[model samples]
Target: MAAAAAELLSDEGYRADGRRPDELRKVRARMGVFAQADGSAYLEQGNTKVLAVVYGPHETRGPRSKALPDRALVNCQCSTAAFSSGERRRRPHGDRPASELALHLKQTFEAAILTHLFPRSQIDIYVQILQADGGNYCACVNAATLAVMDAGIAMRDYVCASTAGLAEDTPLADLSSPEEAAGGPRLVLALLPAAGQIALVQLSARLHQERLETALEAAGRACRALHAVLDRVVRERLREVAALLGD
Candidate 1:
């Protein structure tokens, strides 16, 4: 429908970023990035970068009515840098989309966290996107998982997330911004990797019924791969902490 436009997928089936259909972007992450917070982590997936910080299993503040009787209340906030991307020049935080993302973050963690252990308490997760190449939500979830771990919070399992998009019958793993803008079918999935449980699934655009599983499986595989990267980051952080303590 357009002239002089770069294809989302090249003739050889490689994405614009030159990744294979099932290959994820390079993932790099660090845990305990902030000493003041209960837990903090910074993560980068390709060019999408996010920071997450966790504060408190502390007593709930404000209205007693807001406290959950059976589990700790999970509060989440998400913010994106005004200049995170090429065209995003204004503040997007606190808007409708940001609020919805915050809600999703809250829900994603609620399923993974052993919230019952901290009943009547509050756990706050703050996620900030420092860069916005694509897959913002997935990056946020992965960063938050590491942050929660850094805080020593108990969770049912490690939460990992990834996004996939279907292009011309090929399901692309870890959709980049350009791929997402192509307006094809996209799937976002968050998983408790060890439990083989899906914490969240978000689909955008219409995908064939038969292809849904393919897209989901692609996303799941990417999530499992992320689990390995996150696990490595956490372990490396622990070793660093242990070394400092030993010294």
Candidate 2:
């Protein structure tokens, strides 16, 4: 495979993958793929694969030290399988990167969820990276959207996210790991695309203000594209349920 970061090869403006700066990678998602969890989803964007599970709306368990007085407390844990990448990881969770990602995910979901509606409750979201090609944050957000929808959790809007990488003065959409490592500025934006509201924005490196708007816009557009793919998955799931009921 070509390095997504290398350079803009063609003058016509195409990246290593032949996608235009503003074009997103292909996305596919499925809800309720796991039967045990209250809700589960599998999502794939390009070569990255992720699974998200929502296990509660139930009372808080474990130690009471972290319980909250108002609204449900949202707990998030992110883990990547040792074999999720070409290079294996020794430990799964509690690693510095995983812990930071968990916190970010918790914050992002808290923004989308109607937590006020479920006072004194709890929601646990666990995300596992089945394959870590790149843009893990965006993939997690998209997968979590499906899982939350499967759990019937009330939300203001779908939380969609996508990665943007700056290339030759243009912001390219949906970066893979190679592009990310190429040293260009990259931004991960999680948004309630339907409402045009940003839930989270994280930058991998510094980018100039003059180009920030275009990059943000590109990220938002990629997120909207993600939302459409997720919507289709949800609809297909409902149709499957309807068919089962008929049988």
Candidate 3:
């Protein structure tokens, strides 16, 4: 498999889609896109489509067993649609991967949001993957960021995420599934770009010491790029909101 993937690497160091090693898939995002939710956003990166919704700063309604005294509780459920992938999936939650992803997402948002601001409350963030290309984690984070912002939630910084993979000993940023499947180490990073802090880092496969640094650098650059796109979307959303207010 490694040899097969190695063969897929291009002579010019570009992916099959012609993206340079450090380029991200084109991203499109919108905030307050759903009328039903308190906050919602639809985000697209390449062929991956994800929608995130934030439902509350309301009091916890479930079993009191889950309530926290000093801070808001963050409940996150990450589910993919049945037809989200090339093949159909049977269940939305309770599946092992979905359960794990739910926990990870809960952790990621908890770190970014100021939970203390709304004590004894609950914030529910539900993310549904309408399509799966590559970089699903990054897409979820990016979409959720917009949803949180739309909800007028306070946060310390915008958390942007991106993936990096080592191809032909070169670090490639924002890898597509083909590149990811082409084999080598893959690294996913959730970062606070403005603060230059990493909130999460996950590595798969193996990579050398020197290669990891280069990969981290590439991931950082990809995250910064994602940040710019997100910022533009947020600004556009505020403009629309302002116009509606006629001010």
Candidate 4:
């Protein structure tokens, strides 16, 4: 495993994909990607791509039994397409991994959204992974953040997410699939940048106690960087809409 991880970084301090250890992959995003949905966004982080759509802040569907009296219900579903990963998946949803990701997304967004303002209602966030490389959850969170913003829902702050891995005692940010497959300890973080608050943190594999702080710090920095990117995308989208309305 160490050998695989060592190969991830070249002698020149670049990853096999030619990225510096601390650098993130190219991020491309657009808001209001779907007109019919209340809000929608598409995002690509390197080879990973995801689309998120938001609906509601309206009356709860299904049964009132599921409704929360004091705050809005946040329903989230995260799924990967059959061809998203290298190996084709037989089922897209309701599986263990997908269900777990859905729950994580719900918890992350609940921390940032102002649910109390829309009591007895529900907000549905649906995210689909069209392509998978690494950092699928991070990509989903970032995409969902844009979708929520486009919906004009009240949020405490933007939720930005990123993944970090530890290799040879050095912390690496924004890991790609190859880097992730190298069997290193990985840390994922979702942050509310403006408030300097962490919405979610997930650690996979195991790392020495001494390395935990460094990994967390690296993930936080990456999340902040991602927030900057998402902010720019939102501003650009708003400008385009303004121009269209003016015409």
Candidate 5:
């Protein structure tokens, strides 16, 4: 596996996709994709595609016991469609991986959102994977950020995320499916770029302490790059909405 991954980078330092070690896959995003939801967004990073929808800063449903007196309850659900990946999944939700991803999303957004302002209210965020390549968590974070922004919810800062891996002692940014399958140590980071704060960090596989800092720095750089792209998307959508309103 190491030998195969080592071959992934050419002598010219480009990966099989012709991207430099530090290069990220192209990011395309759109806001307000769903009219019925309070807010919605779609994002594509390379071949991975995700859609996110936000609903409510409204009264809690099902159980009033879940409501908080000092802050809004943030609930998140993340699921991949049966055909989202190369191998079809049997179930859509209620699986272990989906449950774990949903929990992570909840924790990530709770940190970025100004929950204190909406005491006794509930906010629901739902994200679905339409396609899967790699870096699903990062893509979900980016999509959720846009959806929340469109909902006009108060947030301290945008949450940007990216994945990094180490191959042959070289740090690689924004890993693709092939790279992820190569079995290298991987790190996922979700950041508040403006405040230089990290909302969440998860590591898969063992990484030596000596190389941890370098890998983390690479992930941070990729996250900041994603933030730039997401900012542009938001601004463009706002401009379009303004024009339509004026008309």
Candidate 6:
């Protein structure tokens, strides 16, 4: 029994996806994916793909009672496409998991955005998982952060998110679906890389107190790595705009 338990994740220290422990999958992204929205971005992390669109810093909708006096209200709606994962998710909307994830996204951005500047207004963020390889929450947050920045929203810092899973003593970064299914406890983090503040942290299950630090360190390292890629995407987007204006 002890030998089997020790070998649960002992595949020569490599993940099923051929990723070494603490390694992240390829990160690719594009900003301004849609001309209609105030801001939009498409991001792909390995096999997982997500799209994010942002509208406003404009007047609050519906009721005036919903507007905040001191800061802008962040409204977030997150969903998974029925076609994602080569399967159907009938009635993905309004489900408990979807609603909870959307709430988490709302909270994450609210903490990062400088809402006081747009008092009485609202920023609407819509993010959809077009493909779900794993780590859907982190991908949504990463894509939305780009959308918000492309919209020229004021934020204290870039919000980068990543997930970590501990397999025995090994910490795997940027979990893929296979890794997630491996049944190890997982940790997700939304962090402000520049400000050194954590916007959100979630653990799928309890982990050993001693292992928690390593898992956190692995996730935090992945977030910073993602931040670098996101930053480059933003800069390239700016250069493209500048070129268009010059032409």
lDDT of 4 by residue, 198-247 (tens): 99998987777789888999999999899899999999999999999999
Off by over 4 Å in 1: 1-6
- Residues 1-247 of candidate 3 have per-residue lDDT tens digits of 4574455467766678888778888999989889999999999999899999999988898898778888899999888888888876778667887787778788888889999999889999999989988898889999999999999988879989999987666778888877777767889999888888787888986677898898999999999999999999999999999999996
Off by over 4 Å in 3: 1-5
- lDDT per residue for candidate 5 within 35-152, as digits (tens), equals 9999999999999999999998989888788889999999999989888988867888888888999999999999999999999999999999999999999999999999999999
Provide the clashing-pair count of each candidate structure. Answer: 0, 0, 0, 0, 0, 0
Model 6 TM: 0.95
Worst 10 residues of 3 by lDDT: 1-10
Give the TM-score (vs. native) of candidate 3.
Answer: 0.95
lDDT of 4: 0.92
lDDT of 1 by residue, 132-232 (tens): 99999999999999999999999999999999877766778998888888877789999998889989999986766888989998999999999988988
Displacement of the residue 7 alpha carbon in candidate 3, Å: 3.9
Question: What's the lDDT of the predicted structure labeled candidate 2?
Answer: 0.86
TM-score of each: 0.95, 0.94, 0.95, 0.97, 0.97, 0.95
The weakest ten consecutive residues by lDDT in model 1 span 1-10
lDDT at residue 47 of model 4 (Cα atoms) = 98
TM-score for candidate 5, residues paired by index:
0.97
Indicate the worst ten consecutive residues by lDDT in candidate 4: 1-10
lDDT of 6 by residue, 1-247 (tens): 2332243345576656667777889999999999999999999999999999999999999999999999999999988888787656678677777788899999999999999999999999999889999899999999999999999999999999999977666777998886786677889999999877999999988877888988999999999999999999999999999999999
Off by over 4 Å in 4: none
